[model samples]
Target: MTDTATPLISLTWTDHITGRRGHLVVDRLVRGVASGGLRMREGCTLDEVAGLARGMTMKEALHYTPGARYIPLGGAKGGIDCDPRAPEAYGVLVRYLQAMRPYIAHFWTTGEDLGLTQGLVDKAAAEAGLTSSIQAVYPLLDDEEAARRRLADAFAVEVDGIGLGELAGGCGVAEAVLAALDRARRPYQDTRVALQGLGTMGGATARFLTRAGLRVVAVADAKGTVANADGLDVEALLAARDAFGTVDRAALRADDVELPGDAWLSTDAEVLVPAAISYCIDSVNQERITARWVVEAANMPVRPEAEALLTARGITVLPDVVVNSGTNAWWWWTLFGDIGADADEALGHIRRSMRTLIDLMLARAEADGTTPRAAAHALVADRLPEIAARYGWYR
Candidate 1:
């Protein structure tokens, strides 16, 4: 494995509000605000948090935000190791809020990530006395309900010209998929996809693909996977999915086969999507993958080793920066316009961005004999220092 010093970044957060004092490992603070998501899971680690922050750094540079110039408001991320479903989560979250209060008031802004809910975010924001004015980097919705309303308003009425499946992250991915398909000169309709994790990102991506005329043969959630080689019943799946992507397996019919949790990886589809967790398809499970194309809908779903293995096998792997353009797009809109109008508009922008980035990256990879991951990194690395230089931050 290519080794480098722990990426230069600052990280300091309260382990437990009542326990240890919080710490900070900031590489460089651009302005008063450093934005990132908070991951609450049992397995979260410091290194992972730093990596995500690095990604934010790259993202901010690529987009050239105001801090992108004068200061480096690269992205920052924080995680608390706890299970969301556990009763302890609320207490832990409160402690987290209490510990992070000082930073949240100044140079750091935290948002919902894995295991974090809107209710939790609202509660924390309330206790912190957070308001719209505090949001110097991204525009903050007055409240969580407003954020949801914005999303609903944007998607409340579906456009007639767009297919139902062509509407979500799947649609965004579909754009990328189409680009990849075109580059290989392969026919689009014959392509099939099996999706792991059917949450907002996964569900949207699946639906969009279906609408784009690609067949979704398998889909899975935390509960279990449901497969139908002929094609999954997207309508039925959506009808049965709960607020948090849970499906009532009791209602599932006998015709559908239930497979172990990671069954989505073994499916015989042209494309595979690991849209669940970060590093879900790590080195251990990388060998079992059967798809020729792997698209990342979730952030950092594949580790370096797994990604390298896939690349060596002649598989097309799309990096999260380009493939998971959905969230970044939303964040941009949230930071700029009124959150309400920007939610849906953000999705449209994400699709276009992913399509364009992927198309460009693939062409570059093929022409240069470099892997997709390397190509994406090179692209980010090239632009980041430029942003730093332009802003006169590097000197």
Candidate 2:
């Protein structure tokens, strides 16, 4: 009954700075040198941390973590159960890092995660005196003007991070869908999409997908879903949206159906993106799923039961870890600078990696009479063992 795929390691930190306690869950250690972002959410729990760690496992398997795959490189995640918006959050963050210094010397590395910022990352690392030889000077780099020129020359596309509300998961979904479409020979020129979450990540992803020529057909938040088959005006929606990604239900009425909270899945569209939270799709609502392809923009949106049903029915479902594998990869890649010269180029590289991995997984799945999830697992299983043997983990 237990999922053996999940990794297990715990790093606990006590912050004297803000008088708080933080725990870093290194879900799974890939190649004994795994890394992930540090998230600070008020209600983060051990179960959530475990789920995230497992997500990282899938990510490292499908998308190459910084270390060589055959080198036992696995996935891990960390969560700080504290309100990041609180006034004394920074002090608490520094103290948390200091407390966590003991285990950090090992192969595990931590970066920024949801509800955290690069400023916090720099502050914590600086206070801990934990400097990486890779990017010896990890600059926060918030100066947009200076970065533009630097990024432009480094990579073809524009590079902007801190300025953008990092919709890492959504971005990964977009890349996955594009890759799926590419393999199906489906043109992304005017594909309609339904966005189920309008949070920071969801919003950012919607913008990117829209700009890339995908007509967003419907968008929904915690409140409800708004639909316009002729393609909902994403820009206007953003303008009208509040901070929580919720649009005023009273303001826009366009043949919208206000079903129960989970009605977003029923909306007709080529792709359905659930990036809001975990377990958005379960066995009960699994039958209502109509999207040709269900791309998980959120971590573990489709529960195991729901995923089994969907897979049995021949739906192409991309795993959350694979679909949302960008930010973590970017964080570690940043340390090496072995990816792209600039942010724009780096993102392009990341996107390409996501696309290729998806395409390869789907292809392998077809040939092996398996699901992409299984195919991805097989790929990781094969790769990790080889790496482990090389590093003498088993031998």
Poorest lDDT segment (10 consecutive residues) of candidate 1: 1-10
TM-score of each: 0.82, 0.76
- Give the C-alpha miss distance for residue 147 in model 1, angstroms: 12
* Clash counts for the predictions, in order: 17, 10
Best by TM-score: 1
Task: Compose the digit string of candidate 2's lDDT tens values, residues 223-328.
Answer: 7777888777776666666645677776665664455566678877888888776677999998997878888877778898899998888778887767777766
* Winning candidate number (lDDT): 2
Per-candidate Cα lDDT values, in order, are 0.65, 0.66
The residue ranges of model 2 lying beyond 4 angstroms of the native Cα positions read: 1-8, 11-22, 28-32, 65-73, 81-98, 105-107, 119-171, 237-261, 341-344, 392-395
Model 2 per-residue lDDT at 344: 60
lDDT per residue, candidate 1, 1-395, as tens digits?
11122434555565544343223333334443566667677767777777777666554544443431123354667777777777666676766766666666666666666667444676766665664212444333345555545544554445443322224445566677777877777776788899987766777777778877788888888877888787877766766777566667765666777887888988989989887788888887888888989988777889988888888888878877667654544454443442334335555666666667787678778787998777776776766656556543422
